[model samples]
Each structure stands twice: as C-alpha cells, then as structure tokens.
Target: MTGTATLLHHDGTEEIPRFLGAPGAALFGCLHRPAGVARSLVVLCSSIGAEWKYNYRREVLLARRLAERGVAAVRFHYLGSGNSDDGSPDFAALVAQARQVEAWGRAESGATRVGYFGARFGALVAAAASADTDMPLTAWGAPGTGAGYFRELLRIERVGRLAEGSAAFAEAEEPRVRLARGEPADVVGYPLPPELYDSAQSLVFTELAGTAPRDVCLVEIGGDGSARRAAESLTERGLRVHASRLVEDRSWWLHDADWRPDETRQTVRNMIEETVDWFLTVLPT
Candidate 1:
C-alpha cells in the first residue's frame, strides 16, 4: 500500500454501516475509527454537482488521512445523490444527514468535539446541520445561501448559451424556467431536485447561523473565478474566515470544463491539511 493508503487501516477499526444518517437508502458508508476515538470526528458532505466526479477520489484520500490523524471520520452521500437513499433530494433530509453523522460520530467514537467538512451544497447542508447542533464548520466553496447558489447555476447556463441569444431563456425546458416552476430539471444530465432548489432559495445565512461555533469557520474556494469571488460574502458576519482555493477542482456545473483541475487539487490538499492543523490548534486540548 502507498503511504496515503496506510492511514486507512486502524487496529480498533469498527464498521458503522449506514451510520451517517442519510435520509433515504443510498446513504450507506463507513466510519473508520482509529486510536483517538475520543478526540474529534470529521464528517464530510460533498458538493452536489458534476464537480463531485472530479474530486471523488481526492475526497476519499483526505478522509483516510483524517482517520490516520486519530480523528474518526464519516464520509457519506446526501439524499438523491451518492449511494445514499436516492429520491428527489430533499434539502432538509440532507441537512439532517450531517446532523446524524455528527450524532453518530460522537456516540460511536466517544468524541464530544465534532467538525464538518462540506463541499458546495454539501457545505450548505453542513452549515445547516451544524446549526444548534454545536459543530463548527470547515466548508469548501459553500454558497452564500440557497438563493445565491441557485443563481450561480443559472449564470453558468446563461453565459454558455449567450450566443444562442435570449432564445436560450425562451425555451420551456430552460433551467431558469424549471427553476421558476419548482420541479426537478436536468442540469447536464444531473437531476436538480426541486425541493432542493426552492428550499435553498428560501434560506439566508442568518437563518443558517443556528448554533454558534467557537470562533473560526474554515472555508475553501474552488477555482471558479467569478464564483469564488462571490463566496467572499460568507465572511460578512464577522466569522473568523480563512479563504483559500483548490486549483485542480473547477466549477463542476459549467458546460465546458474551463479550469485546470490539477492545480485545483493542490489547493484542496492544502485546505484539508490546514483544516486539520487548525482543528488541532483551536480544538480544546
């Protein structure tokens, strides 16, 4: 096994199947427990979109690293996506999933301190899940709110089809149309669950600020130029925010992969590493 692969194996390993509390069925995944079960557990939620495919392996690798560092970690798919129980992908269920992960991580590992690492929609879900649950966030490219995130999606489609003129928006099948209708619409073949869309639009950061965390909430940005720029508004509430980028990862929803991904992963690796380091520094000893 490679050095990276060794971190996954632990002497007291326990398999908590379906432990992450995915709302539906496809949420089945494992929680790897290493020695320091009493420390902190990192629950990871993935970005919901095509970008998921690009970083799936990298996410697993980072989770494995967390296991090696003595923090038992749980990585699972949200409802409607991943292997978890598939459905129309309800946002509420997905948020609850993160809570379930935090709940289970504390219970199974005997750890009181829990941290969440969420990407894209997963990051939003993590934020919601952590609310009132007392978990701090280490989010990567989490959208400002459900509405902002939704707008970014439309921006991509709009920019891509601009040459098609306003005619693109004229079609009944257009994303903007489906969004207005509040139904599941395919975005490059990936189903955009309506419950997710409307619910996201219904939320704001203030509503998301449920339980206050200790101090800093670590945030990572993708190399999606305009998108990352927009993500900065997350810092508005005076949260001690650290901004960084994952170069190898591009905006997954864009019609054309307009980014250099290898550079993006470097940013992700640094973000994960620093997140762990910060966790060690800030988390009470």
Candidate 2:
C-alpha cells in the first residue's frame, strides 16, 4: 500500500509513504523519487530507540537531498519500530529486513544500481546486509561491537533513570538480569529479546564473513575515531574504503528540549552534503 505523494520541492522531488512486505507484517518506508529517471537508489537504514526519533528529520532531509540530486532514496523502519508491524526481530532478522528493503527499493524505483546508507547501530545492519553483494555502502558512527552497543543502550537507560531521581543502578541491572533469564529486556524503551541481545553481543564488524562492497565510505561524526578504525579493519579485508571525519555537534544525542537551531542545521547540512557527494561520485552512470 502507498500514501499520497507530497511534493518536497519545486524541483519535482516527491515523498511517497509505503508499506512493503506481506500484509500484517509490512515494513513502513518512505520512497523519495527524483524528477527524471534515476539510475541509482540508496536505501537508508535507521538506528532504533531514541536515536531513530532524533535522526528522523535529518534522514528525511537526506532523502530529499538525494532525490534532488537525481538519486532515489528510501528510508524505512524495521519490524517493531515506527509505523511497521510489532514484533521483536533478532540481529540476523534485522539484516534480512534490510536486504528485503534494498530489493524493494530497486524494484520500486527501477534503479539499476542500489546502495546503502546507515548511521550508528544501523550501520552495522547495513554492512551485514550488503555482505556478498556489490552494493556500495556509507556507514557513520558504527559501533565496533554489538556487545558494546547493547551496553551503551543499558547505560542510556541508567542515565535516564538517574535523571529522574530513581534507582538507576537497580533499574539498569534489571534488564541484564531479565535477559540472562532468557526474557526480553526493556532497554531505553526498546523491548530487546534475549535472542536478539545474544546475537548482537557477538556482532563484530571486522569478523563479518563474505565479500565486501567495492566502494565504501565510513564517516566519523564529532571526531570519533571509531569510524577510522572500522575503515582500517574493512580495508584489511580488501574493501576500498573512504574515511571522512565531520566536525559537528552530535545532534542525534540532543533532545527536543535541548534543541539548538544553528548547530542542528550545520550538522544536518554537513551530513547530507557529504553523503550526497559520495553517492554521486560512486553512482553508476
């Protein structure tokens, strides 16, 4: 199913909301189509929890910008997130979902070439989904390991409880204990199941199997060296990688109550411009 097209700009770029996959198990997505025929399509994978909410607007702008540059882009939510169906998907299931979206984007956009763009946790998903395929990839602020990312989520939950003047330590430990008992844990509002948590804990990018993409761009936001290390590791595996560092505020961590207009604008612009430029460079003619 699809929603009415909303004109994004006078340049003939439009955003169409869509529901892909089987009925009742559909994944929610927005397809941004360019004015003319697009030879390429970039699928935007999103991080979960609060990070997904924070990056929503930026991703919308990124999709619009890609469409404006004659590249179709689709941003979608996996199962149990956003407007999609409700179900806890494990890490491998998440990767499968991304691959499904990539195929759907290509068929829906009629783009001969397809690529992936993901930030934070989504970066890991994108990389895993693109394995054994020739699809180009752009990953920003990807965590080195799933265990670390899961721990960070727990930390966020703890910090949030502390800010509320509650028993932060106990609340934080509760989730780990629940997961240990083979149950789902509510980590920062996301109900993470034990299977997903265990799979995520073993996810290490450098240890991913299969062939890597020929073209890759690893972006580091706020001078974090993680992206550089990821790029180096991927390079050692025979992937051609471009590492870029952006000096901008961490807008994804900022809440609406702490919104800073100028800083947010700059961050969005830098991210969009860098991504669009890189996409255009590697996009097949």
For model 2, how does the per-residue alpha-carbon lDDT over 117-214 read when each residue is reduced to its tens digit?
88778888887887787788888777778899889888878777778666655545678889999998887676778878888988886555226547
Q: Model 1: how large is the Cα RMSD against the reference?
A: 5.6
- All models: lDDT? 0.62, 0.80
The parts of candidate 1 lying over 4 Å away from their true place are 1-26, 158-172, 210-213, 220-240, 245-265
C-alpha RMSD in Å of predicted model 2 compared with the true structure: 2.4
Q: All candidates' TM-scores?
A: 0.75, 0.90
Best by lDDT: 2
Error of 2 at 108 (Å): 1.6
TM-score of 2: 0.90
Candidate closest to the true structure, highest TM-score:
2
Clashes of 1: 16
